[model samples]
Target: MYPDELERYHRQLLVIGREAQEKIRRSSVLVVGVGGLGSIASLHLAAAGIGRLVLIDNGKVELSNLQRQILYTVDDIGKPKVYSAAHRLSELNPGTSIHPIYADATPELLREVISGVDVVVDGLDNWETRIIVDKICYELGKPYVHAGIHGFYGQLYIAWPGKTPCLRCVFPRPPRRGNGDVIPVFSTTPGILGLLEANEALKIISGVGKPLLNKILVYDGKTGLFDYVEIRDADCRVCEE
Candidate 1:
């Protein structure tokens, strides 16, 4: 590590040690959305000295996004989300390279981006896109850190191909699309889940802690409770194939 890098990540090095820190510095992560969840997760990943980050999101910043998307400000309202996100994250950690893809997560696009990363993080809002990402990651054998938020509730799990149940194994089918394409959400919900997703990614890359595998962790902000649902391998064709 260079002198400036050592100083920038000094506190983190103390926690994970120099070897783990180096591992983190060499790791690349693909974040599949730059909204509420992606905003926070990618922020911490960059701040922690991740070597590279590929961010994909076709949406542009909006006035409504200020409620939870912390990466952008009023000035970024009309800009493409990935561009604004890349600008903010680059400012946070200039050493971490940011590749912002201002496009949709089509299968071809997902394949192109997922091929070069060490791990994949799901920050998508809808199930249709999430399922596509899960299948691609499983097919590519990448560690996928998954999370979802609705209202005051959220859930998280890490889907390790061949070793654990993929997202389809747990859901079987996508939940019905919410009313009018807008689901009520509390800002803190995605904030919490996103950070947890980042934490799992860090642990996976640094080899410092256990990941949430083979089980879904559900969080309820209303009651301040967290519950675990053990997931068994299902007859899903995605991973089974």
Candidate 2:
């Protein structure tokens, strides 16, 4: 590690050690979506010195996103999110390579992006897109970190292709999409869940602690309690294929 790199990540080095730090520096992560969840997760991933970071988002910054999306400012409103996020992450850690894809996560796009990525971060907004990410990652045999937030509640899980039950296995069918659904979201909700997602990504890359695997973690900010749900499917369709 260079002198500046060492200084920048010095504190974390104590916990993960230089060898693990090197692994982190040599790792590449594909973060899908750049909204509430993606904002926080990508920031920490770049801050932690991930060698290469790919950010994919299709939307532009809006006035409403300012509440929880920390990566953007008022000036960023009307600008493409991936551009603003990429610019900010580059400024945060020049050593970390940042690739910003200003496109939606189509099946083809997901396959292309996940090609060389070590891990996939599911920072998407809807379950439809989340299922696509899960399936593509599963077929490619890649590790995937999933998280979602709504109001005061959030859920997180990690899937390792064949080794763990995938998102589809846990939620077999997609929830009915409400007509013009606009669920209330607390500003702190995504912030809390996004960091957990980032923590999982780091551990997965560095081989530090267990990576959640098939277990799902749920956070209830209103009650200030955390719970876990064990997930496994021996005859899962996604996993079986």
- Candidate maximizing lDDT: 1
Q: How close is each model in CA RMSD to the real structure?
A: 1.5, 1.5
Instruction: Report the lDDT tens digits of candidate 1 across residue range 25-128.
Output: 89999999999999999999999999999999999999999999999999999999999999999999999999999998999999989989999998899889
Q: Report the alpha-carbon TM-score of model 1 versus the true structure.
A: 0.96
CA lDDT of every candidate: 0.91, 0.90
lDDT of 1: 0.91
> TM-scores, in order shown?
0.96, 0.95
Residue range with the least summed lDDT across 10 consecutive positions in model 1: 232-241
Give the poorly placed runs of model 2, Cα more than 4 Å off.
176-180, 232-241
> Cα deviation in Å at residue 133, candidate 2?
0.9
Clashing pairs in 2: none
Q: Give me the overall lDDT of model 2.
A: 0.90
The deviation in Å at residue 36 for candidate 1 is 0.2
